[model samples]
Target chain A: MNTKELIKANNDKRKLLTKETQKYYEDMLIYIRLSYDKSEHETEEILTEMLDHLLEAQEDGKTAVDVFGENPKQYADDIIGELPKIVTKKRIKYMGMGILYFLAALAILSALFNVVEHYLLDLNELTYKIYLGTQIANLMIAIPIAFLQLIVILHYLRWETFKNINKVLAFFIYWIFGLTSIGLFFVIIYFMPSFGPLIEWNVWFNLIIGVVLYVLARSVKSFI
Target chain B: MSLRTQLLKGILEGCILAVIEKQVVYGYELSLKLQHFGLEVSEGSIYPVLLRLQKENLIKGKMKKSPSGPNRKYYYLTDEGQEALEDFRHNWEWVKQPVDQLLDRRDNL
Candidate 1:
């Protein structure tokens, strides 16, 4: 199966597992899936294979721990160690997709706020604001913070997963980190004082740029 | 690690390649074949070894629809795998004699 099909089969087969087995297998699933350097195809392939094996074993009254062994983390790591790494060309495509997505997201968010604030004011109060400062601050602070948050949350999930912790608990833990990450973003950031003289960033201008960039970002995603 | 632990991994790699040479098999079926021959190791350990074999290009896996309808990955040996099994047989021939003689004398004692 291709990587996407493998993922679907893995998810479908996982439902056959007992609740306890599903808990353990999904942890291995997250740990293996979230690992940065592994080949995506092989990773998903192995994950599907593992789920199939676990399901069959469960039919005979075995748990995931029984099928994979007691030291689940080591078993997973050993399997991961054998799979190929993502090659450089594909890695570059992955990064390109990520960069476009974030750039589009920040622009769209800024445009949204600008439109909402403009509508809230009376025409007398509707003054043009140069968002050059906000845009620059977003690139400087927001991107890095968002990237850092992604890494931290993925790492946290992987770490928690390697233990006996289940998915429901891991998800709630991620929610707390997510809220804290956004809160951290707003509190520490200061605008760059609207320094760029060339860009007007009027309400419609922001809206247009946001839409165009979002389209560009999504096309990049489809290209990848 | 104990002698069995140290040697089983290396020996299992050869046996796995040999089995794949004989017939196309999935992970569980291959595990059953090994056990039928008295290897008696945990079934889970087969996957890591199969992964290593695939990485080395001694075996290649393809997803095939099983009789039961799920797509299962089946493994078959490459040309390189046939050569590897031959080399393993050659190595085993000499290793077996000395080890057997030593064990045979030890049993006499």
Candidate 2:
């Protein structure tokens, strides 16, 4: 079966597992499934087989812990050791989509602010020129930083080693990081030399670009 | 790990290859086959070995519609797997005799 099919079958089959067993199994499941650079298709194939095997073992009175041994992470690592990595084509596709999506979000937010100020507050800056530095800050510094952060976050989530931290504390950590990145964005833009060719921020045009890019990102997700 | 499990780690792939050589098997069924033949490890342990064998091109898996429940991934021996099994047999014969002779507690008794 294909990767998506295997994943669907896996989700459906996992309902057969007991709650505690499922908890343990799914922790390993999500961890393995999101692991960086792993082959998507092969990983799903094996994970599906793993769920099936675990269910079969459960029939024989074995829990996930029993079937996978005490260290489920170690077992998962062993299995992951042999799975192939994603091809370069898919990797490039994701990276491209990420860049476009990031740009689209910035444009959309700027459009919203412009629209609100002009139409609602009667401010006449709807067609004001956008600074070139903002574009560079976003594309050069912010986009790359966001993608790097995404990679790290995905890695951390899959590791799940943060279970020792309190849930509230983890949320706070994420919140603080979000604030820090935003702070960094402003700091960079402030220091950016504001001299460049005039680039107008036409609200209607940006909104259209944002919608087009939003559509593009959605379509890009359907590629793989 | 016990010395027994440590030793099994090296040879388990061969044992699994031997099992698949006999007939097509899925992960769970292969684990049961190993248990039936007296290997007392976790049933999940076979998956790593299966993955490794597949990586080495010794075996390949196919998704099949099982008679009951989920679509099981069934594995069968490849041409390389058959050759590897034969080599394992030869190597087992060669290695087993001397190890058996050395480890035979009956002689000490």
Candidate 3:
């Protein structure tokens, strides 16, 4: 056969094998995908290469098991096993970074809480001296929320859609979320009078600092 | 794994590098050449090795237009790969004598 005809025949055979071995291929692909953090293009390349080999085996009158060995899953596992060690190493690096980001986020949140408390809470000298207990209580409430926000930001960092987004648009999205978080903080503090006591603000000075810190701490790019 | 399969796995990297060292080829063509030389390897099995080689900077792949289909990733050895092949040749010579002697003794037994 000429090259073109051979190509067509190979493609036809591939289509037939794909129909017959759909579940088999899916099982292997799913295993690989879950086991690695490979990009979609890399994943597709692997699948295509494997399918081509399977088609060639079929053309040679050998079954999939004959070419891929008795257990195709084992073959797939062996292939993954032989992959560069850097894959797991890179994952560990990301995990380390995630932990560091989490700790840094907690530190910033604690500092913000201290600043807000110092400026806003109405306390006499005795209560102010004992404010450590209140600070710890505030931290108990704030840490979990801060951790949840860190997770959300980390998730967005790995998001494929965001990677494909325009840089300017992504920057705008981060600003929007940052501004919204600051606004939400303001609303919560403004309504504090009905639930408890109103906070004393030094006009716009404390508000400006609070908003700046909140935005910096909560920005998606900070965690990324 | 069977002893033969284990042996194939060990030598496959050198064999692939040797092939690409001789000529620039894509995955499918490389697999065909390896099979033609009586190595009983699956066509797809070469890719993981290729990926590792590329990762280590021992080989590089370039996308080139093909006559009958989409662009294909053609591989060629880097300078590092040439050095690796030379090392393999020296090691193979050192290994061949002992391995042959062992097989010869086993046959006599």
Give the TM-score (vs. native) of candidate 2.
Answer: 0.91
Clashing pairs in 2: none
Point out where model 1 deviates above 4 Å. A121-141, A164-180, A183-188, A191-199, B1-6, B104-109
- Tens-digit lDDT string for candidate 3 (A1-224): 23344445434545667454644655565565454445434445555566666655566776666555556566666666645443565455555554445555555564566566656884322122323444345445544565576566655653422134888988997898788766754554454333233344332342455455456545543343
lDDT for each residue of candidate 1 in A63-122, tens digit (9 for 90 to 100): 777778888788888888888999888788777777667777766786677667667753
- The sequence of per-residue lDDT tens digits that candidate 2 reaches over residues A1-224 is 78777878788888989998998888888878777788788888888888888888788898887888888778788888878788999988888888889879987998898888888999877777877755665568877778787887887776655255788988997898789878877887777776667687678888899889988998998996
Which whole-number lDDT from 0 to 100 does residue A99 have in model 2? 81
When candidate 2 is compared with the true two-chain complex, its DockQ is: 0.80
On lDDT, the candidate that comes out on top is: 2
In what order do the candidates fall by TM-score, top score first? Answer: 2, 1, 3
In terms of TM-score, how similar is model 3 to the real structure?
Answer: 0.51
Off by over 4 Å in 2: A121-124, A161-164, B1-7, B106-109
TM-scores for all predictions: 0.86, 0.91, 0.51
Cα error, candidate 1, residue B95 (Å): 1.7
User: In candidate 3, which residue pairs clash?
Assistant: none
Docking class of 3: incorrect
Candidate that would win on DockQ: 2
Better of 2 and 3 by DockQ: 2
